[model samples]
Each structure stands twice: as C-alpha cells, then as structure tokens.
Target: MNSNWFKLLMKATRVQYGENLKLNGVPVVFNKQGAELLIGDNVTINSSFLSNLVGLYQRTIIVTRTHDSKIAIGNNVGISGATIYARTSITIGENTLIGGNSKIMDNDFHPIEVEARNTDIKEKIAARPIVIGKNCFIGCNSLILKGTILGEGCVVGAGAVVSGVFEDNCVIAGNPAKVIKRL
Candidate 1:
C-alpha cells in the first residue's frame, strides 16, 4: 500500500506519527477511542513478506485494546511484522529494532484462573506495562511478555521468551531469557 494512504489511515485512527514514516506495506493498526498510539520520526514498519529479508509471517499488528491503553514508539525504530498489543501501556525507545514475527504484549489477554476465564474475563485479566529502552534490538520471533523492562542497548536473541527486568547492555537469550553476555 502507498505510504500516503497508510498515513491517512493512521490519521483516521488518531495515531500521531512524526515525519518520514515509511510503511513498506500497510500495517494493521487499531487505536481504540481514548487510547493513544504515538510513533516518532523516521520510523520504518515492514508488513509485507518480502519487505524484510528475515521474512514476515504476517502483517504488522499494532493494537491498543482498552480505552486507557497506550503504545508509544520512539524515533528511528524499525518493526517487521510484529504484534504489539497493549492493554495498559508499552513504550519502545528510539533506534530500537523489533524483528520479524516478534510479539510484545502488555497483557495476558485472558484470566489465568480457570473459573475466571469464563465468568470474569475482563476483571480477572492480567496486564502490566512494558518498557524497551533506547537502541535495544529484539530478535526474531521473541515473546516479550507483560511487565518486562529492558534497559538501554540490550539485545535479545531469537526465539527468547522475555518476562523480567533486564539491565542495560545485556545480551539475552533462551526460553526464559537470561543475560548471556553484558555488552
């Protein structure tokens, strides 16, 4: 899709974006009423399969699920077919790279307790805020769960499941992400 048209769509959803926003393909962005989705200058989002060499599994999905939720992406960030869903809040700092097929969510989306799953879905949902600091690189297929805070210049390895507070300049990897190296 044309970048101009995409920008119009973003405007229609009340998503505030800065200059030089490049859209390789039209992304799926849904900013709920009374929610905020802010994108900074020089951002590049690749949604088409061939746009990123890493190969996207699907179009990029950016959603603010609740009225008070927010998703803020800083300047010079690159996203490739990732799913960034926020029930509360999510902030990605400047110059960060969210690799292909990655999932960054600030909510569990459903109740963990079996009884609450059907009876009290909204009230029992678990959610927290996610903060990815400046110049961080989240590798392909990574799952950044609720309450995760990554400090500046951190690098997450592909396929890692990250769900904790990681300090600055850490090289993280594995199922439950560990600090493999400090950069």
Candidate 2:
C-alpha cells in the first residue's frame, strides 16, 4: 500500500492509460519501449496478493518485446500478480478478474530448433493473439497460452494450463484446460 513504488513505476513505463488505473504495488517488469501497453478505465492491479512473506517480490509483469507487439487490458479488470508477455497481441475484455500468479502470453518467445534456440533470432510466425472475453474469471496460477480464446463469462480454474478456444458461459479446468461445465 505504498505510494512510493507506484510513483516510481509510473515514471519508468511508457504506458498509455485511460481513467482510474490503479496499481496496488510495483510490477515485476515492463520491458520494450516501442511496444504498446494500453490499459482501460477502472483497471486495478494488486500484485501483492498470495505472496506470503514475499509480497514485495511478487508483482504483475507486462512485456511487449517488439514494435508490433502489444498488450491491451479492458475496463474494470482486476489482476493480481499476473504476467502478460506479448510478442503479438494479448487482449483482455472488460469486467474480467484475473487471480494471483496467472500468466497470459501470445508467443513461444523462442524457436524449438536447436540451432535457432542459441541464436538471437525470433520466430514471429509462431506467435498468435490471445483474447479473453468480457466478464470472465481467470483463477490463480492459471496459464493461458498462445492462440487461446475464451468467450464471455467463462471461468478458468486455478492451476489450469489453458490453450485453444473455450465457448462462452463455461467452466474450464485441468492442465490443457477443457470445458468442465457449461454455465
């Protein structure tokens, strides 16, 4: 609940924000300047949640590594200790609540090939966009990977590793994250 860290973060990042954007604590990191980070109105970030004694170390991280990469968070979205790394685009719809330690990414960040792995080259073709629909709930420790799309009102269970598309008004769970129930 300190103002000092938030002030420092505000000075550090090139974030283009709308009204009433709140930060509970410092984000772990925000890298790449040419990339865009757009946060909508009434978005709240609480990176200190569920950190136990390591609350100060735990933080929400948003990174866009290239000029074409972007991260967009819609209105009334509340996230805690979430890491959103975008090589392409990652968009979260309005009224969504993302729990502590969740991760959403739109790219692999590296090539699988042994020769390419050691090089500094990136696989731009492998990256895709991640879209989470309105009024969704992403539980703690959930991992939403590249090309994943969740329709409106979907709920992702804690510790779920989600990939692919999920229909609206459903409950998604498990490692690969399947529709557990249709709400």
Candidate 3:
C-alpha cells in the first residue's frame, strides 16, 4: 500500500507516528484500544523480502496485546522484519537498528506451568517492560525477551537470546547472551 494510505490506517488503529516514516513494505501493526503504539520520526521499517540485506523471513509485526500495553519506537530507528509484541511496555531508543527476523517481546504469552498454560493464563503470565537504549544494534534472528534492559550503544550479535540487564557499549553474543567484548 502507498504511504498515505498506510499512515491513515495507522491513525485509525491508534498507532501514532511522526514525520518522514519510511516503509519499504507494509508492516503488520496492531494497537489495542487504550494501548499506545508510537513510531518516531525518520524511522524505517522494512517488511518485504528484499528490503533488507539479511533476507527477512516475514514482514515486520508490531502489536500491543493489552489495553495498558505500549510500544514506543524512537526516532531514526531501522527495523527489518522484526516482531515486537508488547503486553506491558517496550521502549526502543533513537538510532537503534533491529535486524531482520528478530523478536522483541515484553511477555511470555503463556504461563510457564503446563496446567496454567491452558487455564487462567492471564493470571500466571509473566510480563515486564523492555528498554533498549539509544544507538543499540540488535543482530539478525536474535530473541530479546521480557525484562531486558540494554544500555546505550550495546551490540547484540546474530542469533543471540538476550535477557536481563546489560551494560553499555558491550558486544553480546551466544544463546544465553553475555558480554563477549566491551566496546
């Protein structure tokens, strides 16, 4: 779809965005009633297969699942086929690069207990806020889970499974990501 139409659709869905929003292909953005989904100015969301060099497996998906949930993407952010699902809150600071096919979530979606998984899922679900600081780079295919807090200029290596708090200017890699190098 064209830029104008997309902007209108976003507005109708209560997704607020700033000027110079660049869309290589249409992204799947859903904001629940009373939720907030904000995209800052000069942001580029690449959804099409050829939009990013990393070869995206799917289009970019941004959703706010709960009424009080929020997803705030800062200015000059570049997102490629990433899936950002917020049950609580997610904040991506300015000048961040979210690589292709990455997933950022503020909730587990389901309870850890098998019994609770099917029943009373909401009560058992664990949700937390994720804060990715400015100038951070999330590598391709990485999984950033709930409660993650990355300080400014952190670099997450490809395929890393990140959780917990990380200091600034570090290079993080591995399945359970750790600081591989301090930059």
Instruction: Report clash pairs, candidate 3.
Output: none
For residues 84-108, what per-residue lDDT tens digits would candidate 1 score against the true structure? Answer: 9999999999999999999999999
lDDT by residue (58-124, candidate 3, tens digit) is: 9999999999999999999999999999999999999999999999999999899989986866968
Candidate 2 lDDT tens digits, 1-183: 465566456547777667777777656556477888888899888766554232323588888878878888999998888889998899999999988788898888777676777774676336889999999999888999999999999999989999999989999999878999999
TM-score of candidate 3 against the unseen true structure: 0.98
What TM-scores do the predictions have? Answer: 0.98, 0.88, 0.98
Give candidate 2's error at residue 61 in angstroms: 0.5
Quantify all predictions' global Cα lDDT against the true fold: 0.96, 0.83, 0.96
Q: Determine which window of 10 residues in candidate 3 has minimal summed lDDT.
A: 116-125
Q: Which stretches of candidate 2 lie over 4 Å from their true place?
A: 1-12, 29-31, 49-57
lDDT of 2: 0.83
